[model samples]
Target: MSTIIYPAPIFGPVHSRRLGVSLGINLLPGDGKFCTFDCIYCECGYNKDFRPKQKVQTREAVREALEKRLAEMKENGPFPDVLTFAGNGEPTANPYFPEIIEDTLALRDKYFPNAKVSVLSNATLIHNPKVFAALNKVDNNILKLDTVDMDYIRTVDRPTGHYEVENIIEGLKAFKGNLIIQTIFMKGTTEDGKDVDNTSDKYVLPWLEVVKQINPRQVMIYTIDRETPDQKLKKATKEELDRIARLVEEAGIKASASY
Candidate 1:
């Protein structure tokens, strides 16, 4: 199945189960995707044939667009529940992420004071002081951590050369309880037909260790809800997601399954 691609900075005031009515902010260019990790389950599709060159909207342009949208929404009355930083690729990959967040926050305060500022990052940039500071400014800092086992993480997330599992975990540990961890569960037959199931105890155990170390405020567990580039992948059943949530809860962390 072909993935739905929205080529713009502001795509929708779409309904989000976790974030309510979210107004999306796409920092990456509309014509291409730019992210450090090329995950198998990414809704934007795999980054195999794409380059990671950045061509993000300028801070002035994003601010202007957001202000105009907010003003229009205000004139129409009610506003979206959240102004979310999410799009074709990792939002934090934009060099001006911190400035963007600051500008967004200013707009949020001026136009849609009731709405929250949310950022969805892959966690690769968490180690950067600027990125961390920017994330700290947002209301919802949703970071991704699909797995902890190095081999599986490498296969699943396909992170860039600079991103190591240990470094990510180390960065996350500094987050304390200010972070929300997002994990997507799935089962699939690899290109070679080998079954890939991260739900198994072998994978979950090591993953849990990292979760414990990070101690995030909440863990949002969900399965495939949209079309992915890889058709061989199978979505984890609701029952499977619930079981995994239970494991996370038992570890003294809050878990919500959106399967």
Candidate 2:
């Protein structure tokens, strides 16, 4: 299987289609992919494909690297608009996640006070109190919620453990509008030839209702940008995403779509 692993702990002032000019903080190992979900569309590929050469980054290591990058950017180079937590896999999987967030916030305040701190989480760990609290403290707590149907979740996003759709929805609702709900829209055929299409209303309406329930600050809807692990998958059309965005707006929730 073709895959991409982020080979560094601190890299990127890349232009994020959603989060603007962002400096990424990768808390996972530089060599391996560690995540709670093995989603079919994950650009980093499935968790099973990973083989760790480096241990998961520790809090101090992340702090040192981030501070070095920030000081350099602050002193001699361009500044970032946001400090994002995203890399090879789910950043929350890092044991030192909460502390890393603390360090990232302090560095952002010291070097670029105006820069927003964002975390892209899968919502599986939202029930963890420390993770929940840290997410609330960030500027953008982007949580993933692809479909309300459990079967679709299993066939598509593929949560790794004792994941239940109803339970995760309740957990996501705990954020109570303090979060940004990010949904990736796509279509593909399962190994058994079962069709999976989350962009359709049969899926989107129930999901939008859950969005109304969670009542997040905004909903970011986007389609596949990079090559997915599953070659059979296709990105949602811009026209389709636009229609979905309008539905979100009509529900009184702020929405943006990146096609």
Off by over 4 Å in 1: 50-54
lDDT of each: 0.84, 0.89
lDDT of 2 by residue, 126-185 (tens): 899999999999999999999889998888988888999899899988887899999999
Clashing pairs in 1: none
Query: Worst 10-residue stretch by lDDT in candidate 1?
Result: 46-55
Off by over 4 Å in 2: none
User: What digit string (tens of lDDT, one per residue) describes model 1 on residues 137-177?
Assistant: 89999999888877777777888666678888889899888
Question: lDDT for model 1, on a 0 to 1 scale?
Answer: 0.84
Alpha-carbon deviation at 141 in model 1, angstroms: 0.6
Per-residue lDDT of 157 in model 2: 88
The C-alpha TM-scores of every prediction are 0.94, 0.97
